[model samples]
Target: ELKVEQNPLFLSMQEGKNYTIYCNYSTTSDRLYWYRQDPGKSLESLFVLLSNGAVKQEGRLMASLDTKARLSTLHITAAVHDLSATYFCAVVDAGNMLTFGGGTRLMVKP
Candidate 1:
């Protein structure tokens, strides 16, 4: 069975702070993805890490993949109130479906 784990399942930060969320997977996979979800809203894709060392960044968020370690990371930079949301990392399974980690809910306060 494939399992994905994420550290710090919950986070509370003040606006302008920074943090990193770690995602670890139990199996080998070259593809990883990051997503953000607002309360009562659908998830929004943030970054797609496709290969070893693959990295993608947008605004205050960045994501990276280390296939050899079967790990991925989502980095938050200078967080703002609007950045408060639930974040998730998912690894692509052999069946081409996503196996997502337990989401990390973030609360950014001003």
Candidate 2:
């Protein structure tokens, strides 16, 4: 079975602070993605980490994948109020389907 879990489902993140979100999966996966969704909005792509030690980042968000360990990470730097949103990590399975993590909602106070 393939499963993914994320920590701190509701993150009351402080502004200008750094934090890391963890994703742990049950099976070996080759592809991983990080996404962000704002209130009443569709998902926005953040990063796609494809292989072991793979890392990708844009602005305040950085994501890394460890295929051997079945893990992924999303690190945030200097969080701001606008960065408050729901974050999701998804993995592509052997059949090329996506399994999404339970979303993490981050609220950053100004």
Candidate 3:
């Protein structure tokens, strides 16, 4: 069974600060996806890492994947209050099933 864990499940930071959320999986996976969810809202796709060393960035958010280590990271640069949301990372297993990590709730204070 594949298990996913995210460090620092809750993060509170001030605006203009930078932080990184890490996702680690217990098994091998070729595909990883990062998602964001606001309060009372559905999940929104953030980044997709399809291969080892894949990296994607948009605005203040950057996501990277290291398949060999079964790890993925979501880095937030210059965090703003509007960027406050719950972030999740999901890994696709060999059977094409997605296993999601425990979400990391981020709170940005202005």
Question: Tell me, what's the RMSD of every candidate?
Answer: 0.8, 0.9, 0.7
The window of 10 residues in a row where model 2 has the poorest summed lDDT is 60-69
Q: Give stretches of model 1 more than 4 Å off.
A: none
Residue-level lDDT of model 3, residues 1-110, one tens digit each, is: 99999988999999999999999999888889999999899999999899999999999999999888889999999999999899999988999999999999999999
Error of 3 at 94 (Å): 1.6
lDDT scores in order: 0.91, 0.90, 0.94
Provide TM-scores for the models.
Answer: 0.96, 0.96, 0.97
**TM-score ranking, best first:** 3, 1, 2
Q: How close is candidate 3 to the true structure, as a TM-score?
A: 0.97
Tell me how far candidate 3 lies from the true structure as C-alpha RMSD in angstroms: 0.7
Superposed by TM-score, candidate 2 places the C-alpha of residue 105 at a distance from the truth, in angstroms, of 0.5
Query: In terms of TM-score, which candidate is strongest?
Result: 3
Off-target runs (Cα >4 Å) in candidate 2 are none
Which ten residues in a row are the worst by lDDT in model 3? Answer: 27-36
